[model samples]
Target: MNLLRERLTTPGDPGALRAEEGERPQSHARAYQSLKMQVHQLLLSRIDLEAMENLSDDHLREELGLMVERLLAEENLVVNASERRNLVRDIQHEMLGLGPLEPLLADASVSDILVNGPQQVYVERRGRLERTDVSFVDDDHLMKIIDKIVSRVGRRVDESCPMADARLPDGSRVNVIIPPLALDGPVMSIRRFAAVPLTMANLIDFHTLTAEMAEVLSALARAEVNLLISGGTGSGKTTLLNILSGYIDHAERIVTIEDAAELQLQQPHVVRLETRPPNIEGRGEITQRALVRNALRMRPDRIILGEVRGAEALDMLQAMNTGHEGSMTTIHANSPRDALSRLENMLAMGGMNLPTKVARHQISSAIGVIIQANRLTDGRRKITSIQEITGMEGDVITLQEIFSFRQTGVAEDGRVQGYFQASGVRPRFQERLRSRGIHVADHLFDPGRRME
Candidate 1:
């Protein structure tokens, strides 16, 4: 967990800094610095703060504001009301919230907050990365805020264990890497999440997928066909998984296992499990594989693995082949073929010692659909391919793309303009859907049909 609590801002350009900070230091930045120093000095004075520790933010802010007012008045210093209010808010955040990140966290458009040490901060907005001016006062201040967050999640980050993964109060994913492994300074990456998770309708509106493609996916999911989503990092696999999970019958018990518990499945019978990292002594660690095995004993109608990255692939594949036909998970792969290869490698990591062809056969039989997603250059995520796994043919898993997103052209604004096209190859596994009382129209597989 992140646990550094100091921030220091160093202006890179000395001339610009001198110009920004004129003779009398009249800049708002200067005023904030001066006020911050005053607040720190007063805090160090050991003022009676025992009563304020458990107070609500509003009450605490009111009390802190009054204390600041008294200090400024005694010092015979005068300032603008706006500057004083800003200073008070900053102090409140420093004392009660994440120092410089509070504003970015509150911004709905910001999707990620990357703190590279204390001096440089970056944010992801609209799927594009941009550097932000928001930064901490020094490294200690930044470490303090990091400590505040990771500690809440019962994690620790120090010289002994310099890496930690945690979640925020709002379910945002957090990754912290500190020295001596981090090299430069403590590095913190926070993947921000929306207050309300995205739904299928939202994906359609965002053009992540066409209505026709969404319809096909909903049908397949409701039909209890085992599916795998393949995508690169930040390619919207988790969002797509969350949406498809909605198609499961709410009456059926669903168990979700994740490293950070980011999936927002909206079923009444949902059981969420999160992996546990080992403690300070390097013991009592619970991995995703153990959780997957335990989930089987819980009588789950469907099992959702957030993202299979290791030995857990074997158990998840077994779960799909067994009674849990509708089980779903995501994998880091560029295409359906790569997904299978990745699964094969992961299955080997399970210590099963199965032959290569045997693992390939299991992969062919377990997964029914591979939904490949891509994050385009223009910050749009598209389902580039939807392939179905037919049975193995001569030590190979046969895959046929039933739908593909073909980029017709790029718009003048650099936005990608693509349409989903039917591949004309119908899945050979329609009998699986039929067995579950589901039907698909023949025209859905027409070669000339444009699914958009």
Candidate 2:
């Protein structure tokens, strides 16, 4: 008799039966996977790809479902109606979607997907990493999925070029590294995009920043204050940038540049540009610096760079200095001061022969504010600091903190306990906001007020 049938029919020890019940789901999952693979192979051998190409999507799906049902019956598989339906869906996913990852991608709660290899998959849900039961048959199976992803976006990855960046049709960012570079096997990480992008009100609801801080940010954007958003990876830098960009005038011409197009701007007059990687021949490559120079020629009222990492920093700084008042960008840094330092380093990468004092002055004049976002130890993301650049004092760039989140301690449940507070010192940009008729109340900057 089969193990399941035997356990049900000959129940002797209650403790042993309880132990077996605990393992039933995993055993059933393995059986389902085995059945799915068998039926998938049979369906693939029977279907005519050339004939199916002419069919509409709905028609094709209907035909495939009939074929899958026929194949299961031919193989004498004894599955229930629900199991049969699932088997057909799995086959469809294998042929038409991302195979094993289709379900994870459909889940709105999953923010990130990390595939280490065929046997290991992890996902980030509610800011915490958890392992999932998803797996592929082997390394070759994983490689095929990777190839399908990159090819759809007109990108390639092989031994010669084992690293690639691409985005899904829904705009989720994907990074893949394989083989010699990835010692374990093919590895892929996906940063899922939200269907409905988070707004400033959403950030306040999540306690990422206070309502007062959001008011200041909204005023800065409306007043055309050049701002720099500084944060580390996965700290919601791009999300915050998107919210700030929403405040820009709808009539203004906005141009956005990024390695992969992730920003979801709402303005009608906005133009989005993305960088391109070199072909196998190592030719026909386009960099962000090239796009920035071209954006300036396009007569953009504001330039939004997705991130300033290398030589593009100099171009972006020059654009902001030369009439682009409300331009914005983000940089990966630990703090606001560190962000300025990174900009100085990137300027040197552009092969500029400017002195240290000259470089500092250029940065101080171009960037009016630096908003620092951070992902704390407990997996909570918050805007840690907002500092206004008040021009240069001697050789140093003067920065005054306007708002900050102060961490008191970890709670009993391990959540980061913190409060957002104003820094008392009024920002220099207030006058500029008033000049633009954007009034921010003085009470918003009171140091005594705390948001917990």
In candidate 1, what are the lDDT values of residues 1-452, reduced to their tens digit?
11112222123422111223245456666556756755655554534556666677787767776666655565445678887787777777777788789999999999989999987899999988999988777767788888999899788888888898888998899999998887778899999889998888998988888777787899899998899999999899988998899999989999999998788878899999999888889999999999999999999999999999999999999988888988989999998889999999999899999988999988888899999999998998999999998888888888889889888888999888778888887777677678888787777777786655
CA lDDT scores, all candidates in order? 0.84, 0.89
Using Cα atoms with residue i matched to residue i, what is each candidate's TM-score against the true structure? 0.89, 0.92
Which runs of model 2 end up more than 4 angstroms from their true locations?
A: 1-34, 54-59
Tell me the tens digit of each residue's lDDT in model 2 across 77-196: 567999988888877888778899999999999999999999999999989999998998789889989999989888999999999999898888999999999999999999999999
Go through the candidates in order and give the C-alpha RMSD of each one to the true structure.
Answer: 6.1, 7.8
- Clash counts per candidate, in order, are 20, 0
> Candidate 1 lDDT (Cα, whole model)?
0.84
Candidate 1 error regions (>4 Å): 1-31, 44-50, 409-412
